[model samples]
Target: MNERITPASDPSTWGRALDEAVNILSRGGLVVVPTDTVYGIAADAFTPPAVQALLDAKGRGRQMPPPVLIASVQTLDGLATGVPAGARALAEAFWPGGLTLIVRAHPSLAWDLGETHGTVALRVPDHETALALLARTGPLAVSSANTTGSPAAVTAQDAYDQLGDSVALYLDAGEAPGQVSSSIVDATGETLRLVRAGAISLERLNEVTPVEGPTA
Candidate 1:
């Protein structure tokens, strides 16, 4: 049975919820957590089996890797290499929000996110609960909490209906503000390319840095 945690409850309860979520993640177990955009299924990014299990839960394949949710913008450097000036500028402008930067992975990092092509997508979600959990678990490989090709879950219950017992814990912060997914920008190359457009509009991205490619 999955543990359902409402973090908005009393103080002691919130602490217990956080502890449960952290313990599950540390053991390479998957959890459904709230994000600014939507509910996300998260697992320890450093654990290959955990990451693979997340994919299996979603009925997804290695071709589509999950994005890494971070606690702070400062953690970006340790996970990615050759960060571009524009990427840094964008992070400063839109971080702690919906913006995923695809950058080259650290050469010596011993984690496989599957078909990442030597790169990793990193983001700092705007939700407090997610940040708090991320602060404890380091980085989590997170994706929309739904089966592959299904609509993203906007609430923990919606996620549970689909994911069921696959996730070890569910951090329910009520319904999420269902918005577009994070805007993805490939910063690994010299020219910043827009891979997917979502909450962050193209105009907004251009304001931070000159982004190339067709909008999603």
Candidate 2:
């Protein structure tokens, strides 16, 4: 099928664009969407095949699983088990912004995001268009909108150029607000470890709760 690019910011097309994105995701298709940090390729989180397809599109492997994006902080407990006190404080302080937390997944959930090793990375993007899409589709398994070794996309066209027909649709709401990705913290253990440094600094994260550097 041919790729479809929708102008998500157009008042005349906003509703239609969202509906089409929701339809595409419902069918387990891929979509390139704008977020506060950068563009991302999104798929239904619960669909294993769809998640695998997204990994394939980026030439990524099962070792590096995609993060799940939720519309709100309330959804965290629904997806993750044993979320730490620091993690909850961090979420309350900086959620709906650029911070990703890695915690143990609820064992009963039936979804394969590939080699998560019982842990799932979750984020709540601070972009209206992304939030709108998440509101309709629930949690989405999303990765940066770029092929392996390429820079993450800042605009829909950039994502399209890299992803092409691999993505079913591109939600173009213009450039993403930030070029940096979200800072990732692993909260499953006794200490919160900063996994990947990005938009939020370690100092800033510590202001809310103690965050240590990556494990040796």
Candidate 3:
């Protein structure tokens, strides 16, 4: 069953909550966590059992792979390859924040990360708790903490309401900032392409990188 931890804003409670979350993760358990955008159910990226548990909890199909969250842009180097110059620029400009990137995965992955036909989706979340957890666990495979085809949860209660006892831990950092999920960009090329649109505007992306239209 899922248990709701106190708000992470409280320094003392926050430390306990973070420690418990990390312990659960290290033991291959799933945690419903807060991110800059929405609540997501996360598992250790390198653990096959953890990945499977996350997928099973979501009742997700293997055809659609989950996205991985990295602690920083530097973490991307080890898990993925061919991170194009434009992608790096975007990461520098908007990382440690919203923005999921689809790039080629490193050849030597321990678990089945996803089926992007060789590509992987990665993001660096912009939350202290998220970053702290990532730093401790390395990287995490995370997706919105809701049943497939359901509206994303923006509050801990929403997550608890929908996910119920499916998750191991619930990190309630109060309500989310309410920003939509990051706009996805495929920058594995000289130009950036908008795969999905959200809080990060296309114009803003253009200001920093060449937000090119998709190529056939």
Clashing residue pairs in all predictions, respectively, total: 0, 0, 0
Instruction: For residue 74, give model 2's deviation from the true position in Å.
Output: 0.2
Candidates in order, TM-scores: namely: 0.94, 0.96, 0.92
TM-score-based ranking: 2, 1, 3
For model 3, the superposed segments whose C-alpha errors exceed 4 Å read: 213-216
Residues 1-216, candidate 2, lDDT per residue (tens digit)?
Answer: 224778897656699889999999999999999999999999999999999999999999999999999999999999998899999999999889999999999999989999999999999999988998899999999999999999999989899989999999999988888889999999988899999999999999999889998767
Task: Indicate which candidate wins on TM-score.
Answer: 2
lDDT of 1 by residue, 1-216 (tens): 335645543445578888988999999999999999999999999999999999999999999999999999999889988999999999999999999999999989989999989999999999888887888889999999999988889888889989988998888888887456888999988799999888898899999889996655
Q: Which of the two, 1 or 2, has more lDDT? A: 2
Model 1 backbone overlap count? 0
lDDT of each: 0.89, 0.93, 0.82
Instruction: Give the root-mean-square deviation of each candidate in angstroms.
Output: 1.9, 1.7, 2.1
Give the better candidate number (1 or 3) by lDDT. 1
Q: Model 1: runs farther than 4 Å from truth? A: 1-12
TM-score of 3: 0.92
